[model samples]
Target chain A: MTDWQAFFIALLQGATELFPVSSLGHAVVVPALLHWAFRQADPSFVPFLTLLHLGTATALVILYWRDWLGIVKGFVRGAVRGRIEAENERLAMLLLAGTIPGGLIGFLLERPLKALFATPRVAALFLILNGAILLTAEALRRRSERRDLSREEQEQQFKSAQQITFKAAFVTGGAQALALLPGISRSGVTICGGLLAGLRHQEAARFSFLLATPIIAAAGLLEVPQLFSQRGPLALYAAAAVVAGLAAYISARFLIRYFRAGRLDPYGWYCAAFGLLALILLR
Target chain B: METRGNPALAGVVAALGALFVIISALYAFGAVSFATSDPGAAHHYKHALVALAIAVACLVAANVVRPKAA
Candidate 1:
């Protein structure tokens, strides 16, 4: 990939990785739609992709450092006492419950899934499907909201992300596995899961972001050694990573504020429209 | 008031985590083969990393489930 191409791809990764859109889908379809020559099968490609992921992961870590610190401290305290009593400790376990399913599934199925669905045409189709998933989630959430709630139930509707049950967290985390498909969005599905679990949009988004950090970081860190072993434009790759990190940081900051009152409708429409346009053009 | 813990479950979970750690170590040291016919450095690294993650999760879960006496 040229420097400019790498830069653009990095920016895309940073933004979409956080946005409720599918980054992998865009990575596949965008280049093909634009007729860029880079293939996913290129030897250096995986390592480069991992570097970009690492950059995004770092940005997330930095953004949520306070929360992470609390989680770690709470986890350690709980571990030492052999009891998860604190909110932070419970949140830590909730995240772990959520992480396991997706991590295992991703580890086992990522290659096969990518091989089967990594094509631009396939990605475009899934991108459209992703939009459908988002819209369905929104519709369901709206439906749930319209139902009259008892006084106690009304309090439950606004439960903080950290207050969600372990089962809910696990299900939400499991939803992330769907993102292995090129066009399925990790954040999108997790947020949907959170919403279904009774969190408000902002809280669901928060949980989704927290749940994402570990998996993304793991995906990137696992490939760190390869980043050095593979040759060609190391400096450029590093620069791209930095750019991706900055982009991701910005996107994350923006989304946290946006989700306070924003719904996923705009993103849903964008994904559907963009995917359709790409399908027609690529054909 | 007193709180109780699930010792048996915690032990099982910890044991499972230990098994994964052992398996990861074996794979890293070439004692066991991974999915690939001739697993290269990348495959090994990936397996080891994944194993480590599973193990950590298991250990943490075990810790959380087994409460210390108060």
Candidate 2:
């Protein structure tokens, strides 16, 4: 792999990974569409992918540093006392609850799903479905009392992410497990789950990002051993991780603003159009 | 809490992303090269670099053309 190729991959990884669009979908589609000589099943490639996820998770942490710090400190305190009263403690538990479903699904079915559905054709098809899912979620959210909020109303709407029930978070995480498929998005599904649980757009999005961080980081953590054992693109992989982290921070900033006043309609349209074009071209 | 939209931040990011594209393109066009004492290693390295340049070019175009989140 070349320096630029790594940069390119990391760029996509950063931009799409958390944007309610499927990074896995893009990973499958872009390389095939461009006819790169890259091989996904290669031993080195898996580690590279893990590092990309790590980069994104790092971006999430960097952007939400204070929130994470408070959560960590509160969780330690709560664990010691065997009680949870503060907002951070409640939120930390919610995030943990939200991680279980997707993590379990990924652990159980990742290899088979990748084997069966890694093709551009399958990914493109799922991308179309993912579009429909987003549109449906947006429509449902709009019909409710808890639609997208204004900057001022946002503060009044939910006191904290802790306002959401632990059961709701778990269900949302379970919904995220659908992302085991290449084009089924963890963020989109979880955000939709949040919407259904009566959170506004920004609230849902915040929960989605928080819910995603640990899963993304844990994925990379598990693969760290493989990275050490593998002999490929060490320096390039590191660069890709850095570039991906930079892009993800910027993308995350844009997305948080976008969700406040915007619907997921644009992403829905993009997924639909791009998926259709890929289907046509690949056909 | 990046609550409000900021055009300046968007522009800055776009410019930075564009820079990556240009630099990658230059590398692809052979504006950059590496030297090695071993002929075979050098040949392989050069080939890989050129291929990477091409790949990056495609990615940069795709990234630039894609819609922004906002």
Candidate 3:
């Protein structure tokens, strides 16, 4: 792959990786639309892309080091004391539960999903459908309430991670499995699932990010072996990966703050516009 | 809490918005082409390097400038 291709793909990886829109969908669709020479089976291209994902996963870990550190510290302390701390122990268990569904689903279907990744047009169609999912989710959140509480009151209800239940986490995990398809946004779907479970927007977004940590790491671990089989200039790929990681980290920081204070409507609108554009252009 | 506007914070936000725009434009335009011709290759690589350099410079500047909180 050329340096330019690496840079663009890295940028795409960084931006869409955080945005509710699907990054994988963009990765698959953009190259196909442009008729780029790198095929899905190209050894150099696959390794190069895998390294970019590693960069993104690294960025997520660095960006959320505090959360991950808390889980680890909590687990170790609980083990030493032979009693679980409620907050820390609950968090650790929640993460474990959230990861199980996707891990199982992905392992069983990895080969078939790999085949789906090669179909850009199908991914594009799914991207549009993913937008519809987000839109419907937002509407559903607007309609439901615990009782007769007002909209603002309802929004204030689930402000923290403590409010999320074990059932909600499992549902979010199942939603994450949809990410196996290219156009489905892992973060978007999980956050939507959280909203459907009656969690507030910021709370949903936070849970989505926390939940994404392990999954992204697992994806990198699976791809690392394949990356080692390639014969490209490893240094250049490493440099690009570092650049992508830093970009992703900065993007994640901005997004967390944005989701906290901003409404999801803008992201919804963006997905709609992009999905429509993809349909038109790809057609 | 005090609600005064901070010029440095404003600058940081403005800088971030600009960075977002540049990156979005690059993706929208397919400016990182990897076509197999010499000119196409040069165009693609040059754009990538420029974007990487700009992104890194902006990040460093954001860190060093210590934008005062509003």
> What's each prediction's clash count?
0, 0, 0
Q: TM-score for each prediction?
A: 0.90, 0.76, 0.73
Candidate 3 chain A worst ten-residue window by lDDT: A76-85
Per-candidate fnat, comma-separated? 0.45, 0.00, 0.00
Clashing pairs in 2: none
Model 3: lDDT to the true structure:
0.68
Point out the higher-scoring one by DockQ: 1 or 2.
Answer: 1
Candidate 3 per-residue lDDT, tens place, A1-283, comes to 6888878878888778777888888888888788887665455566676777788888888877887888778645543443334676556546655665655465446446756564777778778878888888887876765557765566776646645675687678777878878888888898898887777777787778778877776566656766776678778788878877877888778877776546566667777677678778878
lDDT of each: 0.84, 0.73, 0.68
In DockQ, how does model 1 score against the reference complex? 0.44
* Residue-level lDDT tens digits of model 1 in A1-283: 7889999999999999989999999999999988898876566697788889999999999999999999888778766766777888878778888997788678668777887889999999999999999999988877766468653454356678877877788788988989999999999999889888888777888789899999999888878878777777878888999999999999988988887767888999999999899899988
Number of the candidate with higher lDDT, 1 or 3:
1
What is model 3's DockQ versus the real complex?
0.01
Model 2 — TM-score against the truth? 0.76
Q: TM-score ranking from best to worst?
A: 1, 2, 3
Best by TM-score: 1
